[model samples]
Target: MSTDTGNDARQQWKAWHEERTETVSAPYGPLALTGTYWIADATEGRIPAIPGHWAVDGENGERGGAVLLTATAADGLTVDGRPLSGTVRLTADKGPAAAARADHGGRKLVVIRREGLWAVRVYDPGSAGRRAFTAIDVFEYDEDWVSPGVFRPYDSRRRVSVRNADGRERGLGLDGELAFTAAGSGFTLQVGVEVDGTLWAVFADGTSGDGSYRFRFLRTPAPGVDGRVTVDFNRALLPPCAFADHFICPCPPPGNTLPIVVPAGERRVLLG
Candidate 1:
């Protein structure tokens, strides 16, 4: 690509970052996610602070299992701003929590599913994280840090058990390694293959925990037939774990940590 093309990409990325910051700090973004209640815990079919009873279906060979949310005015519930008194088949949230379109008074209820597990996230504008967010501090983009790299897939895919930020153990799927070099030092990161066959990495560097956030993510587009890819450190991003403690982001595995400091890309969000 020409220098002008690279500059255009950089400018577009800057706009994306600004938009993301605004979205996260919005009234009902991730920062406003106050609670995630698993439906399994609601044995009696009632979730606290959430309207209606939730029960799992489809395990018995039913079509598209649904979380039966029985709403009633007596339960202090209102769906779409109108007093609700019937059941609503809820699937996964298709948009932001604030725009979920399912509400109980001033609260927004979000339905989610993960590996067959069902849960509901409650988002309120009064969340502590939203109130504390001051700014998103990021390292100035350095075009020199962006370079070409290669992806090497393993003979077979592998799953590694890692502790999530929520203190739960979950399996992290890995597909290959992304090899790159920066500041005269070579590095390889374990990456997961996206559905489109691209590679992604969660990594930390010497600057982590001090000059910047502990860890960030890098995503390379789908590799060419020769496995060549563009490794853009200028687009390195701080994980959601940097902003919200409730997120279950995985830590970078061994060897993925670079010895040299990556002085480009996002650092941390300035909070009060």
Candidate 2:
């Protein structure tokens, strides 16, 4: 890359980093999550802080079990916009938190299930984490950190149990690995193939627990038909748990942690 082009890339990275800070501090980002109530322990069909009744449809808690939610006008919740009253079936929210099933004025009530466990998460615009969020510290972009990679898919998808940041064990699905050479060393990261053909990788490096966040995530655009991709360390990002404790970001699966020190990308959170 030419000097001028390299300078432009660095500026673009700075702009991207700045935009990320704004997104995380936004009203509905991860910092806005205040609670996640599982159905098993919500005996009376109620969470301590959330308003409304939430009960699972199947007492057996099967993998595909759903929840039944009942709210009243007095509960101060809305569905799609209008006042909510009466019972409604709620499945795990497949979209973003912004599109959660229940809306409570400035907050969103999101229903989610993990490992056959049903739960409801609350995202409040006025959450303390969002209020305290200031910025994310990042390393300057270096051209040498970017490398070409190949995605090798497995014959079939595989599911592995890993510990989440919430201290719970959950199933993480992997379809392939991205093998690349960076900083003069070879590395491979197990990734999940997104529905849209993109790729998601959760990984850690030597920098973890030394000078950077314990782990970070990297997302790549869909590879071509040949399974070739550009692994850009310059775009490494901190997980949602780095911004909010209420989130359940998954830890890096075995073999996803690299052996070299990755000195680029997001390093830490700067809370105000």
Tens digit per residue, CA lDDT, model 1, 166-188: 77777778998988888987788
What is the Å distance of residue 247 in model 1 from its true position?
A: 1.7
Q: The CA-based lDDT of model 1 is what? A: 0.81
Clashes by residue pair, model 2: none
Residue 208 displacement (Å), model 2: 0.7
Off by over 4 Å in 1: 1-10, 60-64, 76-83, 94-101
Score residue 236 of candidate 2 by CA lDDT. Answer: 94
C-alpha lDDT values of all predictions = 0.81, 0.87
Over the stretch 1-272, how does candidate 2's per-residue lDDT look in tens digits? Answer: 89998898888888988888888887888889898777788868878887888788875753447888788899998877778899877788888888886888768889888778788888999998878877788887899988889999999999989889999888899999999999887888999999999899999999997789889999887999999998888899999888878778899999999988999999988888
What is the lDDT, from 0 to 100, of the residue 229 in candidate 2? 92
Q: State residue 67's C-alpha deviation in candidate 2, in Å.
A: 2.0
Clash pairs (backbone) in predicted model 1: none
